[model samples]
Target: GESVGLHLPTLSVQEGDNSIINCAYSNSASDYFIWYKQESGKGPQFIIDIRSNMDKRQGQRVTVLLNKTVKHLSLQIAATQPGDSAVYFCAEITSNTGKLIFGQGTTLQVKP
Candidate 1:
């Protein structure tokens, strides 16, 4: 629930650059996809989401794409900024499992 003490993979990008974070999900039946951003000392915050029936969805400066063919998911951030530096996670939930699964985690580092 908290990102207070976690070591995650890192993805560095320059300011105003586009950043793409990818995740591979193991469950083919997962019906819901969600992307979360967790800054230090806080719980993961919702960024964007895509339904299994949808190939792509966009929210503000963020875009989420779902590839059922490869069981892959990705989040794209346009014009990355310093405030965007945080741990990003991809989550999937299925009706039968009733539990949300989170990706390994990736820390986005926006450099000046």
Candidate 2:
């Protein structure tokens, strides 16, 4: 069998600085992508999303970039704060199933 996916499990950043989280998806047929933030003891919250038809999308202080060519996606946060410390996950919805498949999450630790 061959490996189909991968992720970074942790990321650290200083408070008031910026953070960028990356994800690589294997399913090229996926047409939608999303970034989620989850705090301790809480469920994941949606941060931003981008469709395969688009390359980038922005929301509030967050930005999501998608590169279909390499099946790469990234989330960018500006002026990250303590409240921004959480586990971030990237999910993709495949055209075949229309169900979201989540990648291994990356924990964002904002050092105060």
Which one wins on lDDT? Answer: 2
Candidate 2 segments exceeding 4 Å error: 1-6
lDDT of 1: 0.86
Off by over 4 Å in 1: 1-8
- Reference-based lDDT, each prediction: 0.86, 0.87
Decoy 1 TM-score against native: 0.91
Tell me the tens digit of each residue's lDDT in model 1 across 10-100: 8999999999998888778888988999999999999998989999999999999888998888899999999999999998888787788
Q: Compute the lDDT for candidate 2.
A: 0.87
| Superposed Cα deviation of residue 87, candidate 1 (Å) | 0.2
By summed lDDT, which 10 consecutive residues of candidate 1 come out lowest? Answer: 1-10
Q: Model 2 reaches what TM-score against the true structure?
A: 0.93
lDDT by residue (tens digit), candidate 2, 48-106: 99999999998999999998999899999999999999999898888878788888789
RMSD of each: 4.5, 1.9
